[model samples]
Target: MLDFPNWQNWIEKPSSIIKKLRQKLDQMVGVEIKLAEARSGPPTGMALNLEIRGEDFNQMSEAVEEIKQKIKNIPGLVDLTDDFDRSRPELKVIIDRDKASRLGLRARDIANTVRTAFNGKKVSVFRDGTEEYDIWVQLDQSFRSNQSDLSSLFIYTPSGEPVRLSEIARVDSGPSYGSIRHVDTVRTITISADAFRMPGPVLVMKTKQVLNKLDLPQGVTYQFTGEDENRKESQIFIGQALIIAILLILVVMVAQFNSIALPLIVISSVLMSVMGVIIGLIVHDRPFGIIMTGVGTVALAGIVVNNAIVMLDYVIKLRKKGYQRNEAMILAAAVRFRPVVLTAVTTVLGLVPIAIGMDIDFSRESIILFGAASASFWKSMALAIMYGLGVTTLLTLFLLPALYSLVEGGKERLRGLFSSKEIVY
Candidate 1:
């Protein structure tokens, strides 16, 4: 997928259309904005990573708070989240030379000794599963005791000297640099998240506001990127493809019907399918989530169009073969019943995979979309097609009869135009 390498570049680069749209978004429903990487991980496109940093724990916490505010203020984002404690690592102590020399010690000694105390070194080595494991013995919790013990601890010098750690430098504990997690490496020191209620333009605007408001500290910078970015690219590409597909369907319908008006009537049955899908979605109380709404909408159109074509083609064939309009309509209905039933039933069966929410992740939103897209959903879809199809059917059955009757009744009126009133029965 194409990702904006630098969202900052795009955000900073002036676009009149984008600016105007943003203004309207501000005036209307507002927007949700965010600053994240296009993807996390290394450049190989094989992973994702999030690296967060803060001046101090307090500063880190403040930065996090700022992120929360940014997320909340985003226009359509809701349920902002991240993996809890995913980036959180405990304090790890590292020594400073100047401070250590002021007392009488070196950084190496403190580092080495502390390493042994916290993370022991290998005193023995063993082999297991074609791999080597180094084992060592060292002081545990009760022995190390507290920070006071670190100062009181003694270390040996290269000159066969022993000195108290406090005499050489300060002993402290603080947050560590690296973070740990299950998935792609996302190491954050101080970061926050904001999710929007909707995707597309709404999320973009909200994120814009956040980026504009951000006040960066010296040596601190950020970027705007995430799944939202991925979504935007996908939406654009799919939109074009969908337009092409619809045009193709229209062409196919026109070719089959050979009449612009009736073809239009049949093609429009797609709308009934859409209405039914929407009603099902609404009744099931599912919001238009990222995945569910997109695929479901496209699928609905095909279902409706296919159904209409079956019925219309049969009726048109009968009419072209010299049967009276009403007779043709009834005959078409009788002949098409088996095919129509088979098609509808098969389509519903095909939906079983969808009903299982294959695309919707195992998240709360997924459940909502799937539950809302309940079994009765097909019924709603059928209702819309039924309305259009029923109307077309009735017109087909009654059109020729009505026209003939009207012409016969007007025979008297026609006599005025004929000089020799010779009428043949």
Candidate 2:
């Protein structure tokens, strides 16, 4: 309901605002609030959603309450609540079958008479002009509102005798569930909360640690849902995709170089790039975005290897021209330095605007800085590439050449050792 100005105009972050609101609201008696950021993506529900499932509602509700009590005080967990609501007030009627049968009245007759008295009966239809309306008849509000009115009411028997309804049935009022939920044909109660000032996964891990200490009843178990579930699934998918990408890149490099060692040397750049990705996220204090950052890392695997491949390929060409191994590597580094630096520099420059959410308006001749919501989504990916490529570029120029030299030296030593051995036969 409360729509604020654009994100650029906000003086404080949304988290700060929610924290202030929570501080003030927590003092109010019987008041609870759930605050969430407006995001455009798949529905992930709350940051922490734990579901306690069982066939017995009573046991499941007790377990859910116990879990909530244990986790309610956890730091950074807010808006703690559950889906097991049983606060609705309802009236139940119990019928005495023997009494009703002896009076020549069936259970259906008593049910119909009580239902008609309270909910009204459609006795006839009224036609006005071209439309028809149903006419219902029932007791007035004053007469039917009190429980004592049920005892005064009468039910007609099959022999046309009037029998007091209270003699055959009794009514009791109590609290009942507002609604019930089921998952996979099993009853489930979900306890959900938002994570504040802490990562969602960390909060979930803490909650799990606390819940694991409890000995739940038989046939009752809990599982995390919502964002936790989605996060796990996404991590698995991205991990598999990253592996497939590395394998595919390795295959391509192998075919191009026609040598396993050279391709593996090129692939080492990917591992070096991963180090940069971690450094970037840590320095920026941003969580690792599973989808964006992961995809960016996979894409970086292909990009960083190009610089290594370029430098290594040129060294091979130089050596093929009769230059010594050390001389060829030195010359290749000096000759290819400009092109390699320029390639990485241009890519980093291109991603700078996106990473910082900056845009240019030619018509207004103005620069928009950190004003695009869409830009935030891709910021992780852009930074992943920029930082990764930056680090890999340096390593490609320095460390990769050393590794190539070491590998080549080892290969030559093995070849020379084999040739030096005399045949025993």
Candidate 3:
């Protein structure tokens, strides 16, 4: 319930320190503490927001407790808690309608008397030189501490007789009323937690697995919100963007090459580049489907095609200049090898440091490159770009020449079969 100012020495393991403090604090009476750190992701400090809705508060409280337990079992999910507090003691006054009616007392009179007694009635405002304070009148704290004292309160009846509250009302002690949350007109309870040492997608997958096993009561359902919702939405848009980019690239290539086959040959190399992307992510222990990784894959699409386009253009020029198909292909591959290798190597080398987490520092004030947290943010992108470009370059030099030869040879064979004059019967 308290936030400590940054007055203590820095510790490397804050969670461990908090655990130690919890152990000591548990033994003390009337004091309890639970430490929670802010959730990590985007600008919203929420990794998981599970909203449970039901008509009954008791069922909802039980469901919240169950979910909190399951969340604790999940690895790297920390600081789990719900907003409801159902254990606090409260005193409820149940008015007897028949007894109140016989005494000529209305329910409103009893309610108003109880409210005025507990909440205090403000009578007058005392003005000071610069400040005004309200004077309130209420029973002494000692006389209002227990349910027996509340039952002993007296209120005036309509016949001008004073009757004890116990004559027409009863006081019962039980669980206090907690806050009720509403979403779209239905009551809801949210259980939230922070993910530690894991990404948002992975945590969401794990949470889904846990939730799938539960058999929720009728009229009770759950939904995900906060960062998880945003992540899902962003993934859909990213997929659409990638598809549009591919279509745009294909259209441009079709115009430049004037042939569907050549454009396909160029676009197919993007798949080859994706092989290297998968390998890089696996080898570097990074998760797939990250925003930066998708960005790198899109960038690789444009980059990998450049080399193939250059080599193909030269082959076309040579063929038009009266060179044989086989001769032009051999020459194109040989002459373009240096340019292709040089371009790929320069680009890969530039990004290799970033892939390996050697951060690029543009600021002259700091020479530190590696071991910073921010450096790893771009690690997935760099690895995808570096490996994708390298692998696709090699595939372009070798596989592209073979594909072109096969397509052209098949066309030549079909032309000879259709145009031949010789016939035997």
Candidate 4:
């Protein structure tokens, strides 16, 4: 954290720096890796989280000894652990579809019924003299855990004839692995063999590199999609908003100053502000989220133009006082330097609360008018502000002045020649 930040109370400094540093470290690696394994073979593993095409669980197992050896050798590895090898869970269950049909049911229906029975879905409750008890209707636990007993469950058809559930469906058991899901798609799980001293990104990258060379089983597949998806979506949104924002900013400034040429000068500072944004993202290694992109871009519109406005305001005064164009620009630049710097700095400092994810009461109507948003939204906003202001301030106060002096001087000279014929009357 910079000591001379706009807000200077030295509260919550450590967390902010830590957050920034972690993001930076993550960017140095080629890619993040993820892998998943499940009980394999026929019946299409996909029924639960059907295996992805091209990912070979069997092939991955073959490399386990090599993986184990390398992991042990790596000095950077802080911790290596496994969820399998005695620690592994039993995912095996057999559904007798034929037996289920005999009971006028499907295997899914039985599984759902069994899960519901244990979970105890509430039916209703009647309060009796303020001593209320919950009323639940579900299958008894005895019926769920026992496989042989399950085959003995009785089912009655519409004809009122009693029949054994085993008559229609078969019952069996096997081991299955829990899945890691993405957007409702159960992809694969990355078993983290190491942590501690190992950099999080390096482990993720190396695992993927080795995994890539190996061939996967015919149908099962695996791939990596961690922050990449998040980053893509953010870039798209930020990119769209960025384009629209630039256009809108031009519209607003052209509308405000009512001069096409002047508006061009005004808009140049926004581009300069982006230079700061890139520096910040590089410095902090932020992923350029849509929220950050939007906030930073919008901030560019406001913060960047501050210096331009100062210059413009001075130019207007000189023009109104009937000064020559070239001399007026140079004077305006000199005159407007102080307030422009102050304004940009003040705005950045003012938004520090939002950048740090600090909380303020927004429960009551009074606080709502000026209070923090919910945690997630507030955090995104704060990051937007923190990054946006820092970037915009640098471009606006320093680089913008140099750029403005050049662009404005040329425009001013052209305007003078064009208006030279104006009457002195």
lDDT per residue for candidate 1 within 81-151, as digits (tens), equals 43334243454454556756655567666788877876687789889989998889777777677787777
CA lDDT for candidate 3 = 0.81
**Most TM-score-accurate candidate:** 2
lDDT of 3 by residue, 314-361 (tens): 999999999999899999999999999999999999987766556444
* Candidate that beats the other on lDDT, 1 or 4, i.e. the better one: 4
lDDT for 58 in candidate 2 is: 92
| Backbone collisions counted per model | 27, 0, 0, 26
Candidate with maximal lDDT: 2
lDDT of each candidate versus the true structure = 0.52, 0.87, 0.81, 0.54
The candidate with the higher TM-score, 1 or 3, is: 3
The predicted structure with the larger TM-score, 1 or 2, is 2
On TM-score, the stronger of 3 and 4 is: 3
Could you tell me every candidate's TM-score relative to the true structure? 0.46, 0.88, 0.77, 0.49
Query: Model 2 shows how many backbone clashes?
Result: 0
In terms of lDDT, the poorest run of 10 residues in model 4 is 42-51
- The runs of at least 3 residues in candidate 1 whose Cα sits more than 4 Å from the true structure, single-residue gaps closed, are 1-60, 63-106, 126-135, 140-143, 173-266, 280-286, 289-296, 311-425
What is candidate 4's CA lDDT for residue 379?
A: 40
